[model samples]
Target: MSRIAESFKNGKAFIGFVTGGDPSLEKSEEFILEMVRGGADLVEIGIPFSDPIAEGVVIQEANIRALSAGATVDKIFDLVASLRKRTEVPLVFLTYLNPVFNYGFSRFFQRCADLGVDGIIIPDLPYEEKGELAEIAAGFGVDVISLIAPTSEQRIKQIAQEATGFIYVVSSMGVTGMRSEIQTDLKAILEVVKGVSSIPTAVGFGINTPKQAGEIAKITDGVIVGSAIVKIIEKHGENAGPYIYDYVQSMKNAVKELD
Candidate 1:
């Protein structure tokens, strides 16, 4: 089984996310390592893009911060290689279609395999359009993860059928940001997804607190947290490690308590 799938086997996976170079590569590495140590079964690192269509202001600003710090695809790949030597946790890249295309699909997926990245998430790559790189990704042993939004009612089953790594269930209709509450009919959505695919499903978007994580865990295999963690790094910079550990630990604890 792929490492990402293996994570869900233990319990509800706590997937932590942070833009690779939010402030600096060194700081990013430090904080992300803390997240792993704290109980992140899997982690998604953003490859900062100028126009993150699926992202809200929090992640959009994080992209700017990373870019300003000299973040590049090549640089992020190197960082992942370095990080791989230290941790066995599954690492997935959260990026856009443009960057992967600009880098060349075959080349990008090859680089991910070389660097130990297990999966890739291109939010803008629709289910119908995923064929653009899905074949190439599989050739390199890198799974192309699918994102199913609330609007994707009929398509959820189709997506789950061919899903490779895991299904990223987008909890809200809008972009990535912490919301006061998740208003989507995810319970019904998940029922369809679970009925069709055996692959694990993890909900992302608008999850910030442990309460949110615990609540969502009841329906899905995991929680993907982005904005909240990135916001912490944006405020704390290099000293964000301890805070990341605490937050991830709490979220993990919440999931465990549900069990």
Candidate 2:
């Protein structure tokens, strides 16, 4: 079974996140390897953008550093292609709609297919605006994962119905970052997602600890931790892999509690 599906069947969903050119492409590769070994069922590699308005300070800085280091969309694809040699765990590309458009949707999805990417997550692509890209992705057998915010209810159903693979349930109303606690009623939110999506539902945003991951896993298919992992990369530099491995292992152990 694919690691993602297997995790869901085992009553636990894997945590995944977008790691842009933060430390460096080479270092990020090692970090991804560690994530898999540390029990990540999937990995979302972020293609750095110049105007990352949806990210927090930490992530924005990481993106800049990545861009400054010459991390291009093409380079990101090459890294993803190389990753295919190491594992079968699903790899999802996370980016803004602009870059996808610039690269040409049909060609991008086709290349992603060739590279064995399981999915794509375009944060700015609304369900109402995804007609062309969605059609092309479906034709290429690439899953188009969609997101739902705290305020979205009716729209959530539409996104879930049209979305492939697992749905990314944004745990907060704000942009991506670490938080003290996700103040929203995630249980109610998950129920809304469950009502529309036959696919698994994974919660993200503001999750930073195993305790939080365990709490969310009780009612959802998975948990996604981002800024927390990025911060580890920031602090440990080249040692990011070991730090991520340790954190992910802790989250994995916590999620296992639900099983």
Candidate 3:
């Protein structure tokens, strides 16, 4: 099984996300390791972009912080290279398409393959346009994960059928951030995906708290927590490691209870 697929086999996966070079690349590495230590089955490293259209204020500010701190595509690649020496936990990139195109798809995916990145999640890349990188990425054994939003009613089946790795089910209609409640009919959307594909599905966007995680885990194969963790890092800055570890441990335990 692919590393991404293997992550879901153990039970409901708890996927954690943090911006690469937020505060600093060293700190980013530290936080990622802490997430793994706390029980993240998979991790997504955001390659900071100037205009992260899919991000809310929390992550948008994180992008700015990372960029101001001199986060570069090459630097992020080096960060992943360093991370591979320490852990084998699945690492995925949550990035926009411009950076990948600017870095050159073949070179980018080659680096990912060499550095042990399991998959990638591109928010703005439409399912129809995924061919722009999907073929190249697959050549290097990298799965181009597909995102199915609440608005993607008819397209959910089509996206699921072609998706590699796992499908990211957006829990609401808006961008990424924590919400008081996810009002989408996620169970129905997941039902469509399951009908067409057996690939694991993880619900993200606005998911925070163990109660929310456990509730979502009962319906999906996994739960992805990004903004909530980013908020923790934002509040603590360089000293966010222990806080991250504790928070992730609680979130992971929440998901683990389903097993």
Candidate 4:
């Protein structure tokens, strides 16, 4: 099985995301290791972009902080290279298309292959336009993960059928952030995806607390927490490692309970 597929094979996956170089690249690596130590099955590292259209206030601020701290594409690649030496956990890039375009798709995916990145999530890349990078990414064995929002009514089937890695089921309609409640009829969406494809589905966007994680895990194969983790880092800055480990451990335990 692909590394991404293997992540969901044992049980419900707890996928964690953090903005790369948020506090600093070193801290980014530290936080990721902590997440793995805390039982995260997969990790999504955001390559800071100037205009992250899919991000909310928390992550947008994180992007700015990372950029200001000099988080370049090269630097992020180096970060992944260093991470590969320490862990084999699946590492996926959550980035916009512009940077990949600027970096050259072939060169970018080649680096990903070389550095042990298993998959990528491009929020801005539409399903139809995925061909722009999908073909190249596939050549290098990188899965271009697909996202399905509640608004993806008829297209959900189409997207799921073609999806390579696990499908990212967006819990709400808006951008990424924490929310008190996610009333998007997610089970209905998962039903559609399951009908067409056996690929694992993970719900993300606005998922924070263990209660929410457990509730969502009951319905989906996994739960993805981003803004919540980023919030922890934002509050703790360079010292967010142990806090991240604790939070992720709690979240993972919540998901594992469903198993």
Q: Please give the CA lDDT of all the candidate structures.
A: 0.91, 0.83, 0.96, 0.96
What's the lDDT for residue 230 in model 1?
Answer: 92
Residue 259's lDDT within candidate 1 is 65
Task: Point out where model 3 deviates above 4 Å.
Answer: none
Q: TM-scores, in order shown?
A: 0.98, 0.96, 0.99, 0.99
Q: Is candidate 2 or candidate 3 better by lDDT?
A: 3
- Model 2 regions more than 4 Å off: 1-7
- Model 1 lDDT-worst window of ten: 123-132
- lDDT order of candidates, best first? 3, 4, 1, 2
Candidate 1 per-residue lDDT over residues 35-124, each given as its tens digit = 999999999999999999989998899999999989999999988988988998999999999999999998999899889999999988
Supply candidate 4's per-residue lDDT for 121: 95
Give the alpha carbon lDDT tens digit for every residue of 1-259 in model 2: 5444555676776766756567688887888889889988778888899887778888888898899988988888888877888888788888899999999988899998898877888888877878888889989988888888887876877777776788888888878999888788888877877887678889998899888899888988888888898888889888777788999999988987888
- Model 2: per-residue Cα lDDT at residue 238: 86
For lDDT, candidate 1 versus 3, the one ahead is: 3
lDDT score at residue 235, model 2, on the 0-100 scale: 90
